[model samples]
Target: MGKVRGELRSHCPINFGIEIFGDRWTLLVLRDLLLQGKRRFGDFQASEEGISSNILAERLDRLTHYGLVTAERVAGDRRQIRYEPTEAGRALLPVLVEMAYWGARHDPRTAAPKSFALAYEADRAGLLRSVEAGTNPSEG
Candidate 1:
């Protein structure tokens, strides 16, 4: 689990996790970073979910506070900032993958691409490595 900034709701692992990322937008932001390689604020703004600037800002702030992400100004470009996931954030990849798998199995209208499911099942570790390296496995 990622580091908690404030007092946790309880000692239960599930409750601690929920307190950190239970919000609707937090997981989506993580998806963009982990899967889509989105780093810039504008990139997140362009996500299909259409998250507003205010909400995105808040989520990013919270993620940073929890040590899941690191935000830094781009080299030689103080006006532009990039956000990258820390190790704790990358550790959530398995959770997201499992959730996607569950959704694909249970939801008739699931949107997860079949290719991704196949690759995930074929080599889960390789897929995780590719994602952690900021590469889209489907593209490679």
Candidate 2:
């Protein structure tokens, strides 16, 4: 069961955010869902990070419980479920983008581009708008 806001150790917003994504795998699962557009269990397993099956299942369940993702059966396939981000999940785009910027800035070998940080810095709102409209800064 998810820890409700009232049950949290503190009412701090940052603490709430950390409670959702403090683990290593949760945010990566979200990155795949929101940024990489991966939906299947196999798809997430195939990620470069190579998360284990048990951990992925747990994270997906947690995300569903927390209203961050929705799992629906694939058309004509009851066994194959597709996962998608909910409004709450999509709202994490800024966090993802900021992390990308921070990584690109600090890491010499980061795959993230420096120009995107410049782009985001110049028009933070516009970039987020574009991403929400299915045009991501991560795309070529």
Q: lDDT value for candidate 1?
A: 0.84
Candidate models: Cα lDDT each = 0.84, 0.84
Lowest lDDT sum, 10 consecutive residues, model 1, at 1-10
Per-candidate TM-scores read: 0.85, 0.87
Clash count, candidate 2: 0
lDDT digits (tens) for residues 51-135 of candidate 2: 9998898889888888999999999989999999999999998898788788888898988776677778888888778777777
Model 2: which ten-residue window has the lowest total lDDT? 1-10
lDDT of 1 by residue, 1-140 (tens): 23336788698989977887887799999888887788999999999889999888888988999899999999999999899999999899888877777787778897877777777888988877876676757554
RMSD in order of candidates: 3.5, 2.7
Candidate 2 displacement at residue 106 in angstroms: 1.0
